[model samples]
Target: MIANFSQYGIKKLFLPITSVVLLVFGSCKDKAQEKPTEAMVEEVGTADGFESIFDGSTLNNWDGDPTYWRVENGSLIGEITPETLLDANTFIIWQGGEPSDFELKLEFRISENGNSGINYRSELLDTIPFALRGYQADIDGKHRYTGQNYEERKRTTLAYRGEKAEISTQENASEPESLRNNVQRNAWQSRKVLESLGHMDSLKTKINNDWNEAHLVVKGNTMQHFINGILMSEVIDNDSVNRNASGKLGMQVHVGPPMKVEYRNISLKQ
Candidate 1:
C-alpha cells in the first residue's frame, strides 16, 4: 500500500511538470515559425505584362517642347532656366492626354537646395501658377527626402520618414494616462487599433542631394510612391484631375533662388 501511494504521488507531480515543459517548448517553436524571413521584404522590380515608355534614343512617342526638355548625355534633361520658365511658360505636357492607370520611373539630379516635382493628373493652367489640380510626387533636392505626396495642390507634407515616431508621440501625448499605460503595455495588440484609427505613420526616409530613383505606380484609384526601391507613401486619387481619366503631365521647376534641377530616365509602363 505504501509503495503504491508513493508511485501515485510521483506520477501526479511528473505529469504536471512534463505538461508545463511541453507547453513552453511548443510556444517557442511557434514563435520561431511566426518570425518573418528576409525574402518577404525584398521587392522584385515590375512583375509581368508592363511596357517601357522611353526608348533611349529619342522622345519619339512623347510630345513636349524641345527647348525645355533636351536629350543630354543620353538622358532626357529638362532645364529650368529663367528665360525658358518665362518665355515658353515652361511646362512639359505629355501630349498623350492621360492614362487611367500606369507606372512611372525616373532618375533625377539637382543642384544643392533645389526643388522640383512631377505633376500627374494635372491640367495646363494659364492663370494659376501651379499644376492646377492633381497629385504631385515631390522632390526636395536639398533635403535628400524624395517621393512625398502633394495632394490637390496642398503643400503641407502628407508623409515623411520618422512618420511613425511622430504618430506615436502624438498619440501618447493626446491619450489619457491610463490609456497610454495600457498602450505601452500591450503595444503589439494595439497595432490593429492604431492602424484603423490612422495613428500609424509611414516609414519612408529621405535621400539627400544626389541622383535618386523615383518610381510611381497608379492603378485605378490607388497611387504609390517609391524612392530607391523603398515605398514612401500612397494615396487614393479621387480628386478632380483624376476624374477626367487623363490630363497633362508637368514637371515643376519651382520658383526659387537660381537653383537648377535635372531629370532623366523618364519612362512609363502601362
Candidate 2:
C-alpha cells in the first residue's frame, strides 16, 4: 500500500513540473510569434509591387557626372554649386532597363531654386554627353512646375499640372471633341489642350518643401503622375510621330542657380 502511495505522490509531483514546463514553453512561443517575421517584413518592403533599383551604396548600373551625383544618406543626391553650374541640363541615366510599361515610385526633396525632373521613355542625345530627350515629370523648387509633363529637348510641356490631355494627330488639336471637351491650350501657339484635372491650390498644399512621394504610371502611350496620393496629371499620347515607344530613364540636373535635389526609395515595377 505504502509503495503504491509513494508512486502516486511521485506522479503528482511530475504532473505539476510538466505543466509548468508546458506553460513556460507556451509563453515563449507566443512571444516569438509576436515579433515580426521575415515574410512580414518583406511584405512591407515590396508591398506596392515595386522592386528597388538602387542599392543605396553604389552607382552600379547608372552613368552620369560623378561630381554632381552621389549616394549620400541612403539617397541619390544631385548638388550643383554656383561654381559647378552647367551651361545645359544634364542627366543620370538608369542602365537597369528601359521599362516601357511600368510604375515608378520614389521620394524627392529639393532646395529652393532647385530644378529637377524624372525623365522616362527617353533617349541619350549623341549631341551632348549624358543628355536625355523624352517625357519628363517635372519638379521645381518654386512648386510652379511640379507634376507637369514636359519633354526634354523635344516638344516641351506636353501637359501642364492639373490637366488631363489627349494628344493626337488624328484630329485638329484645336477641335478635340472626340477625345475631350472643355479643352483649352496652354499656349495659343500650341496644339496641346490643357484640360483641368484638379485645382492648383489644392495640389500645392499637398506638396511640401520636405520629402514628397511621387508615383508615376506609364502604360503604352498613356502616362500618369501622382504626388502624395493625389493624381497630379495624366497624358494620353496618340501623336504617333511624337510619341516615344521606349527609351532610357534619366534624372535631370537643370542648369540654373545653385541648388540641390535628393531622391530615395527609388523603385520600379514592370
Candidate 3:
C-alpha cells in the first residue's frame, strides 16, 4: 500500500510540471507573432499630420517667379540667376501665401564650396541686406560652420561649435565630490556657443556632409532648432531678434555661379 501511494504522488507532480512548460512555450510563440505586426503599424503611420510642401516635380505650395526657382530630379533648386538679380534688384522670393506657427523639416545637399541656408520668418527686401536678419539655419558643404544659428537680419550668431574638454575639466576642478558621484554620466558630447549672450551648451551629435536634416520648431514666444536629432539652440523672443508672428520662407542660393544646392522632402506641421 505504501509503494502504490508513493507512485501516485510522483505521477501527479509530473503532469502539472509538463503542463506548465507547454503553457510557457505557447506564450513565447504568441509574443513572437506580435512584434512584426507592431512594426508594420509604426512604419505606415509615421508621418501623422505633417504635409509635404515640395512635390518633387514642381513648386506647388510656394509662390515665386519662375526665374528664381526650378524643379529638377524631385528637388526645389533655387539659383541666383544673372537676369533675376539684374531685373529684380534683389533675390527672388517664394511665397507660400499662408503663414503660422509650425515645424519645418527639410534635407539639403550642398555642392562643393556651396554656401546656402533655409530662411524662415523672412521678408522680401529691395536690397539683399544681411542674411542674419530673420532666422537662418547655417549650411556649409564643408561642415565647418554647419548648424550654427545666424539670427538673420539681426547680424548675430546665436550658437556655434563647442569645446568638450574645457567644459569637463572646469566642472571637475571646481567640484571634485560632484564628479565622483556623477562619474558615470557622459561628458558633454556636442558644444553650442551662444555668441550673442556668451553662453555655451551641449548639443546632440553633429551631422556633416551627405544629406543633413534640419528641424525648426516655432511656437508662440519660443523657438528651437535641431540638427541630426540634437537640440542646437533655444531662444525667447525679445526686441533684438523677434521674428514676425508670421512671414515668408525662402531658400538661399549663394553667390557662386557654379554652386548648386538641392532641397527636398520638405514638410510642415502646425
TM-score of each: 0.56, 0.78, 0.59
Per-residue lDDT tens digits of candidate 2, residues 218-270?
99899999998888888888777667888899799999899999999898998
Q: Local distance difference test, per candidate?
A: 0.56, 0.83, 0.58
Cα displacement (Å) at residue 191, model 1: 20
Best-to-worst ranking by TM-score: 2, 3, 1
* Error at 88, model 2, angstroms: 1.2
Q: Which digits, one per residue and each the tens of the lDDT, describe model 1 over residues 171-240?
A: 3322345344533322211211111212223433346457788888878666677777876666543333
Model 1 TM-score relative to the real fold: 0.56
Better of 1 and 2 by TM-score: 2
The numbered model that scores best in TM-score is 2
Model 3, residue 244: distance off in Å is 2.5
**Collision count for each candidate, in order:** 4, 0, 8
lDDT of candidate 3 vs native? 0.58
By lDDT, the best candidate is 2
Where model 1 places Cα greater than 4 Å from the true spot, the runs are 1-47, 57-67, 81-89, 126-132, 152-208, 237-245
Taking all chains together, the TM-score of candidate 2 against the true structure is 0.78
Model 3, span 116-172: residue lDDT tens: 777777655645432223566667676655665554543235445332111112233
